[model samples]
Target: MVLPALMLFVAVVLIPLAMTVLLSFNDWGQYKGIEQVFILKNWREIWEDDYFLEMFLRTFRIAVLATLITALLGAPEAYILNRMQGRWKGFFLLVILGPLLISVVARTLGWALLFGGANGVVNKALMSLGVIGAPIPFMFTETGVVVALAHVMMPFMVLSVWAALQRVDPQIENAAMSLGAGHATILRRIVLPQIMPGILSGAIIVFSLSASAFATPSIIGGRRLKVAATLAYDEFLNTLNWPLGAAVAVLLLVALVLIVVGSNALIERRYAEVFR
Candidate 1:
């Protein structure tokens, strides 16, 4: 049973990944196009270039911020949703997930319109509310990208924490309350610990997706602010530097794999007794 699945995985995922890795070792030029010869030129260029360094750092920074925002907001929202009863729960859940039903491109374009510089809807609304003295730049900025990406990725975080909440015993809270534990203490000690796995799982999902995200970042950050994904896209499509793009993509994949695996290991260790 597992053999067939493993074979399918190798065929669908591993083959393309291996090919991409091989392609990264090949050479490319403006006039020459892609040359079949294997070399470390692409990798070496990425390693030595400060531009690549800044771009990767910016990419991870945005991903981290987006993940943190989602965790902070989504965890609480999920808790609230879990506590609600009947149709109200379903209604709010639907509203929370409405964004997921739309095309990511469409959603991002909507954000682009809202984030239309100083005259944008967001800025105007804030100005009207006296939230700021002047318009803030949203279009073509990292803040815009982070905000959009967080919105896009929020559903995953909420759903993950909701699932974790399902495994939690409601009586535990009651038991703690019976022992003279206040609401805050019960929540801090009993609820959060139980839901931690979900939060970590959601963080992994959000962070990984955010890091590799292309569309939202491209639309929000524009040409001036380039993340790793957009930079790879430019190299492949605009510059016609497929080898270089492949290298960048492979590096991103490797980084994400390492980070996710490390995160999982830490989570497992920390939650060993609880999970067991």
Candidate 2:
């Protein structure tokens, strides 16, 4: 049973990935079929272009910031939820999980309205508060992009962090308290250390998701900030450059692989240290 499923997964995921790697090295353009010989132009071009580096830097920065900010926001929420019992717990889970069920298009549209220029709720509220003399630049800027991406990626981090938090035996906390540890000391010495793995796992998910996100950044970033995913989308879909686009896709995939592998190793090391 599992063999068939595993085979199917390999067929779908690994096969395309292998195909993309082959495509990235070839110049399969509109003028040519898969007949073209392999070339390093795509990789070379990406490396030489300063703007490309900026786009990648911006993307990396945005993803990092969004993951950190959302983790901060979600960790407390997850902790609170994990502590609760009964109907309230289920209801709260429903609330957190509700957004996952909603279409990404729908969520993006909602944020667009709030962040719309001038008459928008966000701009209007800020203006009323006299925080700025003019509507602060948003909806196409890095700040707006980060804000939107954080909301979209929050749930993954929250659940992971919560699971980590819940796994820390209650006895450890009680023992900390019994040993004359302050609230802050208990949190720092015991609770925080135990939950570190969960937080790292959440950050890994959040980072990967945001890094690969195209829609939210496209709609909310509004063409101003181009993340790596959108660049691939434009190259493959818009320009009909399969080879170049596939190359970009492969790049994104490689980045994801590296981050996940490195982060998991770090998590494992921390787990060993903490458990030892």
Residue-by-residue lDDT tens digits, candidate 1, 1-276: 799999999999999999999999999988999999989999999999999999999999999999999999999999999999999999999999999999999999999989887899999999999999999888888889999999999999999999999999999999999999999999899999889889999999999999999999998898999999999999999999999999999999999999999999988887886568
lDDT of 1: 0.95
For model 2, the run of ten residues with the poorest summed lDDT? 27-36
Best by TM-score: 1
Clashing pairs in 2: none
Which pairs of residues collide in model 1?
none
Worst window of 10 by summed lDDT in candidate 1:
267-276
Predictions in order: lDDT:
0.95, 0.85
TM of each candidate vs. truth: 0.96, 0.91
